[model samples]
Target chain A: MKEGTSISVSKLTKRFGHFTAVDAISFDVKEGEIFGFLGANGAGKTTAMRMLCGLSMPTSGEATVAGYDLYKQSEKIKKSIGYMSQKFSLYEDLTIKENNRFYGGIYGLSDKQINEKTEFMLHHLHLEDQANTLVKELPLGWKQKLSFSVSMIHDPKIVFLDEPTGGVDPLTRREFWTMIYEAAHRGTTVFVTTHYMDEAEYCDRVSIMVDGKIEALDTPSALTRQFKVQGMADVFVQLARKAKRSDN
Target chain B: MESIQVDHVDKSFQSGKSPVEALKNITFNVKQGELFGLIGPDGAGKTTLFRILTTLMLADKGDAWVDGYHVVKDYEQIRKRVGYMPGRFSLYQDLTVEENLSFFATLFNTTLEENYELVKDIYVQIEPFKKRRAGALSGGMKQKLALSCALIHRPSVLFLDEPTTGVDAVSRQEFWQLLRGLQKQGITILVSTPYMDEASLCDRVALMQNGSIMKIDSPGGIISQFQKPLWAVQGDNMYQLMHDLRHDSRVDTCYPFGQYHHVTFNESTIDIESLKKEFQQKGVHSITIDRTEPTIEDCFMELMNQ
Candidate 1:
């Protein structure tokens, strides 16, 4: 563990049966830094993220998340970090207020704190009028925005977002990134994965995974300069095109 | 002759107590062999429209035709000629890739050998694992299998709904190239996507919002119609810079673009250097501003604001 380092991984790897999903990879994320985890389909990004979030065990490597050891304190790591993915986050059947309160309770917040936080979050999102509205009834953008807000109800040290802005409108997508920026500004380290190359530019540093290995890692500008490419999209295509594990 | 014709189509769904309008007076046409795109986000009625045209669902009002056959009356004809790749992978997961393709071919009374050339380019990519179950395949491979199944019958019209929604940039580009190849083969393709960048790939795109068509034009035509002076601004502190720009009188609209904040001004003559200086004076330093082209995303946001 190092001072001001929110996450540190040294040769972290995950293997399944005969296949090495995530080969030995190493990276460090500073506190409050927005780290972009990028990869093509079946490039082992999910496998690696699962290990860091304590949802899956790493086969071999040393890592620390939110000041907790990756192996010994996985439960503690789970408590100190938040996660939201596009595929699943909030329960669609639950009302907006209920979803917020439920997540707050799951994080072990007191009843009084839950109520207060729920009100503050609703007010910030301008959803006070729709507090009792079921999440399924909300628009796609509103649902995603509310999902992110609920994930932060407990104020974890680091938040993991997996394709958080997928399918949202262009404007709403930017608004979602603004929320991410605000969260990082408040000292919450953001570990995010997105398919959108433009979003990669917003990250302080990005690591691109190819064939279970981190083939490129640097600031966006540095990466563009190093690859001699016009943008992150071009850089991504060039690197991801060489991947051998397209079959998953 | 038009490959597809949608006339004043309307559809709605019953949700709880009220009826939600999924499509309201939607009308559009795709010409023969033209690569038309339905550009929209989720719940924009793209899937609803696709269903109506594919003869899987009927509209409450108006009529549509595919390959000169009525969507409702000649649904059998429409179904025979149209190929649909749904947003979700709706294939037999338990079936192997080869099995799925062969099953679809059997359904259309055709053999794999008969239509091999149609899907060869895409099929060969996944052919190595022809024995692999569809469920075990990755996202990209699954999509290819689905497309192969959709094209198994060698239909005249292809309807792809958000085929590139969650796909990566590289795979998405590959998919579009495949669509272009299909178009060159004289197959009229209708595809929908949430990514604004993909709009440029379509010969023409219809921007849909809230169950209504916002605009329909070529990507270049749409961008040319952007009636604003757009500028790309980059500052050291983007969060603060955005806040300051939004409140400033000079900035009419501001949105975060890649590596820069795209700010638009009402004054067409708003000089870039002067705008940069004004922001620098407001304690926003390390500023760089340049005149930039309005992308489909900018045009989309502009249309949304209106």
Candidate 2:
């Protein structure tokens, strides 16, 4: 394992019965680096992400996350990573404070630590007075922002965000990226997946998956230049349009 | 005559004790055979407005008409003339693709054979999976089935709610092309999406936020209304560049856009050479700055701030 690499994978593969969901893929993410994992729907991104997060086992691969072995230390890897998805993360029925405490408990934090962190998070989000308010009562943007904050309650070494700004407004989407940049600035590795090509440009480095393979991996500018495209959107379309697999 | 007309529509939902306003004085009109868009984020009253126009729900204190029929008084007439595809996949999961299409055709007192020409372009893509259950089909295939069902009735006006939401870029482009084909057939299309980029695809768009309409104009019209001189700035260190630009006195608003930081100056014009030299003095090197045109998103943010 490299000294500064947060995640290192060599020829990772996952197969489902007769289908090779994720073909041999290799990549490395450095500490505090913003890595964009991009692909079209049904491009094996979710399958590959599941294996990296320790939620699923890879059929064939050598990988380490946060200095822990992918095969031997899957349990430890889970504790050292934070994850949030646009579809589900925070409990809508729970109050903001309660949700924080619940997640903190799940991460095995002590009650005292949970209390302190919850207060800090509430203060940062400017929801100190509304801590008791139900998450469903808050606006969509606030809920998404709060969800990102709570995902970091344990202050894990790496955070995985799945389309975190899917349907957010333009202004709030920019704000969410700022939050992401701040997290990376604090030396936490950020591994994010998004459909918005514009968001892909914000990544320090990006890897595009096509039909279960890492078709392209480079900085946004390099990828654009290599593809002879104008922006990340065109680069994405050129690669994704040739995909043989149907959309999932 | 307008294909769709909405006049001061308002709707509120009971969250707990107090009612949360979902739509506030929303007014817009879609011309005949025009492709109009309702562009906004989630919870921006788009679905509420769609429901009212489709005659599935009523507004609290306003009127709307679809296909020249009053939404309230002529709801039955409106329902018969409009084809609505809700955001969520409303088809039966257990039903096969073919079955769902036929079911929808039956609801409108029509048959697939009768309207084959109307949906041939979209239906043929999903024909190979006709025997497969709708739930078993892929996202793109499922969307095709839903669109086919919506067009089965061959209604004069089509209402699609966030049809491209969560869809990938390639599929979204294909879907829009299908819509263009429908428009050529003289169908008035009204669609909603959260993607600001998609606004440019429409003939005109109504930007909505916080239960209110911000502006209604052609995409080009909105861009022209943006009177600020914008610039795209990039440097080796993006985070530091953003920090330095935000703190600059002459810079108005700076936000991270795709590959560069989009900046608006308080003054109308900026000295490019001086700005580069000034950044060098601040120790921000490898600076690349150029004047850029305002996109729909830039216009959207400007209107939102106002």
Q: Model 1, A167: alpha-carbon shift in Å?
A: 0.5
Per-residue lDDT of candidate 1, residues A1-248 (tens digit) = 88999999999989999999999999999999999999998899989999999999999999999999999999999889999998758988999988977888888999999999999999999999999998888888999999899889989999999999988888899999999999999999999999989999999999999999999999999999999998899999999999887846
Tell me the tens digit of each residue's lDDT in model 2 across A1-248.
Answer: 98999999999999989888899999999999999999988999999999999999999989999999989999999999999997857888999989988999999999999999989988987889998998888989999999999999999999999999988999999989999999999999999999898999999999999999999999999999999999999999999999999764
Please write out the lDDT profile of model 1 over residues B175-256, one tens digit for every residue: 9999999888889999999998999999999998889999999999999999887888999888889999999887799998
Model 2, CA-based lDDT: 0.92
Interface RMSD of 2: 1.1
TM-score of the second chain in each model?
0.97, 0.98
Models, CA RMSD each:
1.1, 1.1
Candidate 1 CAPRI assessment class: high
Give the top-scoring candidate (lDDT): 2
Q: Native-vs-model 1 lDDT?
A: 0.91
| CA displacement after TM-score superposition, residue A64 of candidate 2 (Å) | 1.3
Clashing pairs for predicted structure model 1, backbone only: none
Name the regions of candidate 1 deviating beyond 4 angstroms.
none
